[model samples]
Target: MNEKRMLDDQHFEQMIEEESICTTDNKVYEAPLDALYDTAMHYCPGCGHGVVHRILAEVIEEMGIIKDIIGVAPVGCSVLAYNYLNIDMSEAAHGRASAAATGIKRVLPEKYVFSYQGDGDLAAIGTGETIHTCNRGENILILFINNGIYGMTGGQMAPTTLPGMKSTTSPFGRDVETMGAPLKITDLVAQLPGTAYVTRQSVHKPGNVRKTKKAIQKALEYQKNGDGGTCFVEVVSNCPSNWKMTPVQSNKWMEENMLPFYPLGDLKKPNGKEK
Candidate 1:
């Protein structure tokens, strides 16, 4: 074959190989974790909240804990999570999801209870409830969605909002001189004696999605094993509309800005194992 033709063929072969890997990865759904419902989510395109929702649903289905699971939905975009998830759910006042979940779990210790909360709700108004629940070692899962802004409430500033980040309330960027620094709930709660598992994960990419699912599954497993401790999963999500950015830009911002402030990994785990 001519040298030019050989180069062309090599290029074609590399393209084919790349395509194959992409196809295989797309098809490789974590068998043990599959969504129970269809893909018609209420969230906007490129919303990390939707991805986390799907992951939790898949985990619950895989573990066969749907019937025994009770979820407490907090104020914010995820307040409507009950509309998508096909399980028993209760709505909680802003930032009081953990308290509500604690009450329910105490009444029904055999049931698997979980709370879905947003950054504003979990870190600000609901901070007290969350802290006490974790400190008391409530046997419940806390799926904390930190999008860094009040998504449902017109893009207001949240306790987890990054320094110098612009929001509706902080139009000129959040000033630490007045607004204070972003709250790192995962690190704070992990220090509590009642915390059994504390992980910070994201759904910004496919690999991160898989890791987030595993973290959630581990939290549920810990609860099933009679480990009466707080299992917290802080998902650094995105709010494209609230942030006034396109979906792609929102994702890029999460990787560049959010990751720096809230680094992802298993912050605290049982047996003192490193993640």
Candidate 2:
């Protein structure tokens, strides 16, 4: 009886030690108090950009890289994303964020460089720049927000627009006969040998938000390692204002339609694990 009681006490002590270690790790990962946007954002209630912004902010704060980070903002609804993020940022001309980021990183290699681009910009106009940058192994993080439509340009059909998806330009739904299939940017970019990490995630739900944060952190950590390669994150975001649907409906569309077309999770990791 005494031996059994002693065994139970040992098990209890081991549980306590494990709990303490987990608590310490959680504290270490706690986000900074000043790591969020200062003002109320104008994004719609169900807009995925807000969730992405918050996750980026938290990752920046948790990693303590804000002081050394430089963000390049692309043109679109996220044009004003620079104003919201409390970090050093530069605005690039429409669809030229990767080029701008390339220049910045070349001049300031020590800084953590990143470019935030949209589907229309990255998969369409800036396709050449995006491909070359990744191919050349530019040490930059490319946060590609693929909402499947051109939000700023009145819901036009973008390169990432899925089949049967309707946009302002495709009022009758995207026709694979002429419009072509949706461009899976992450999958395409992952094929580039120079790319160190490539992942696709969404922010339509709470569980996804957590996963998105980890993905962002992985990209940032890859940059920190001076990987000398591209880290691409294709985020499946929502545009309620342009989609002609309520915020909730927009999120539902993302889950019901978007996920099947642009499935989430890591497409490639050079090291075979999160950085």
Candidate 3:
């Protein structure tokens, strides 16, 4: 017991020493660490998940809703969103994130609830739940991450896969004639009467990161103010590993290829204008 206590004390002292050294710098622009736990992330090095998570944390902290927000996560690349975000979270079945988020928001109307889902989860399997949730105006936020390919599973083609985009299942490039045109889920949800603020934004760079953070803030604001609608924020991200390219190359490819098919901006809103 004596030896164990001494060792524990030594480890604790070492941790404090390391923290003191790291925190000594008076660096400007250091983001607040209130809403994200200090831990290793499982996402790829250049995965936009980290940036998106940081923006969410910034918004939650700025709005003073860190304790009043709940997140619902579905399967796919973001299955572990709850692990990084310091908030009350509930796991949902694959493609059922929207339904689960609706239930949680309904039960606790005062709390801000949001769902973090990937393209495959939202645009394919969860299509019905997503449509219904938006149609009913569940007063929740849907953070849709569309990377065109299934990242969690093998790099399979998704409903949002662009024309001529190659994936594991689409080695010959997506044949739009038979595979069907990409489903613009963001626009589809915006046409629903229950949607309040619907916008497509990216966070590949600092400028876009700021814009995305504001978009998130606005969506939460609408829900908090009893807007009686759904807020859908689509984040066009890249899948470096699945896309078979370096992180930098993948981002560049996304800018050239993905942006043309799915142009960014407000697709739809309650007032027919971005707020």
Error of 2 at 95 (Å): 1.1
Q: Considering summed lDDT, which 10 consecutive residues are worst modelled in model 3? A: 21-30
Which candidate achieves the best TM-score against the true structure?
3
The Cα local distance difference test for each model comes to 0.88, 0.87, 0.90
TM-score of each: 0.86, 0.85, 0.89
lDDT of 2 by residue, 129-190 (tens): 99999998899999999888998878899998889889889899999999898888778888
In candidate 2, stretches whose alpha carbon ends up further than 4 angstroms from where it belongs are: 1-33, 272-275
Better of 1 and 2 by TM-score: 1
Between prediction 1 and prediction 3, the one with superior TM-score is 3
lDDT of 1 by residue, 121-223 (tens): 9999999999999999998999999999998878999999899999999999999999999889889999888989999999988899989999999999998
lDDT of 3: 0.90
Q: Is candidate 2 or candidate 3 better by TM-score?
A: 3
- Model 3 TM-score, 2 decimals: 0.89
> What is the Cα-based TM-score of model 1?
0.86
Error of 1 at 179 (Å): 0.7
